[model samples]
Target: MSMFLVRSFDDPKGYIELNRPDGTLPRTSSESYVPWGVSTHGKIVYAKTGEHTGWRGGTGQHRLRPYDTTVSQNRRRQCQSELGVMILNNPSFTAKAVSKVSNAMRLYLQSQDAATAMACIYKQIGHYFYTGGRFGFGRISESKKDDIGVDGVWRGIMQALLLGRLDQKMSIHDAIGRKVLPVLKGGQLVKYTNLATVVRQDWFDDPTRRGRVNAPVRAPVTTKGGISKLDTPAGGTVAQGRNRGVDMFSRDLHRTRDKDADAYYDDADARNLLFGAGISGTTGTLLQAGIAFGKLTAAEDLKQYTLAIIGYLVGGGMHSYHETMAVASKVGVPYNPGAFETSMPESFRRSGLYTAWRANFYDIVVLGATHWRNNSGYLPSHLNKELTSPA
Candidate 1:
């Protein structure tokens, strides 16, 4: 939600006014840079991120289940938020591909039992890399929100670390910002992104009626870049629409849109990411379900099963930690290193999982789904109160 002064709306010289705002603007500035550290933040981790425009998601999504009430994608903010959302999400335009050679290794090491314990220990990192039709990583609580396949803690961990590689792949904006760039004066994560590539030309088409940079009252920018848009993938509005996570059987699918909220997601590559995520998340749930049913063939050996279960927990925990450092990946936002601290482990500390994934974390991860059920929290108290409260 940070902003730069465009000098004059009537005739922008392309140079932003550099004087700091006098406590007037929303503190969304990424210009200032500092070495981010966990100690700087207390118990609750916080990652300051800004929207970037650069993505290839402009298609109709139908495969994954949606919520009862749909969300409006109509973007109406003041500043230009993204050069393009894809710019921040998909960075370098890398295609997601299932590694052929690695599959050979996977097959060689594949487990024939109803469940594969080896997976608890071995994950092919190179298998991801924005390949396999997979794309950008999702936000903190995005996975559970995307599909209704019951992505509990263990399953979420499996999905994030195993099959669902796109959550951390296919982003150049993140790579350059986290790895290539260093934190500068005011904790700014990114320096230059060459955003002109995706800047909507029409916004500047009419030289006379240009979009104001920081108007006195509200956002005047005519593009998607600006203040935070309403009901992000993590917002309360959209989150509540899905009844937290209770409306699992709801046949509706969360549709994808362009930065301008245009219908998209019909291309082969785009579909890859969508279906890839769906399948990945679904696969993890199925595995968890199988485990609940005692489907592991190795359990007959008692020793192996105990060892496998132990490995699953330990390895999953480590994977969750690894995600915190997955810069240019899903866990941490690009350019903003503090985002890592904000990252909640895949199996724990997810977006509002205290309700969405909490019970499952215990039932599945700890107790092996003794009380198996998917509950994303239908009647979220906070959401209900907000809705009924005096506006």
Candidate 2:
């Protein structure tokens, strides 16, 4: 019925005047205050009119009501959650429960995901060559074959493993956008739309702010290549959530609609360096695309490679556009084009491309590795033993 989230909400609080809710508090623009307009009432969220409050924290149409800690205390006293108390008290029991679930999952993944050759892309041409046939994939949810997210999340996992990335993790909390899906309830088909995509990220407000993390468009090959900041602001772009520049991942899955990517990128430098855009800001994404294409397919022949490259470009490009637009449209600044191509860091976790790419990468890791002794090699597993078989 209900689920509890694991991340803290980091959005700016609105300047709430006990009675006056005109989206503004009594404060002059001349006053030096925190990015969150700190007045007698509360946070300086956003003034649509821009007449009284000049600063715009985000693009949310409605302001969040200031939470009262007293309510939580009162609720705790009145009715305590039994499950929460048990989970907190019994650490061993919780660990055992998690292990049981994980063990079952390991079997399922090995049998179906890793060994099974009947995946989305592989189903058609799996048993053909050595490479394509070796790729692994799995599906989640009650999605059909054509769903964008079928191999999406798995792709991200593979990519994370390939890149060995472990920083600035973002957990999907809730989305402010909308997503429509067809579901059959009582054997009847119906449309399902979500209200908001809530997320729990490491740092929503200026992840690299306070002179801590230095986010560039394309990080140098070496430890110290040059000084660069986020060419784009930390607000709008699909990959803006990442400050690591390229070779990273967003790891968020905010299902959004098409109407979200029709605005300009946030131009504020408050979060970026005061000098200018990053080094790779001017560089086009075509090169990046080519690099990725080479790594994935590694086309041996010229003509086939060209044709395959074209197909992948056309398909992958569209997916990237759709996802980036949805992300940019929901939270900050106006819709800016090429958000998937642009922005800081890599938004793989929340990206459809990351899903596909990561899955392929992990296939190489798990199936191709010499750890399992299949008369060959790779991750050792005895779970594949069949009850009855003929030699």
Among these predicted structures, which one has the highest TM-score? 2
Model 1 weakest lDDT span, ten residues long: 71-80
Candidate 1 scores a C-alpha RMSD against the true structure in Å of 24.6
Report backbone clashes per prediction: 43, 27
In order, the Cα lDDT scores of the candidates are: 0.21, 0.22
Cα lDDT, model 2, residue 89 = 27
Q: Mind sharing the TM-score for model 1?
A: 0.18
- State model 1's lDDT: 0.21
Models 1 onward score TM values of 0.18, 0.19
Model 1 spans > 4 angstroms off: 1-379, 382-391
Looking at model 2, residue 327 earns an lDDT score of 31
Off by over 4 Å in 2: 1-108, 111-114, 117-220, 224-262, 266-391
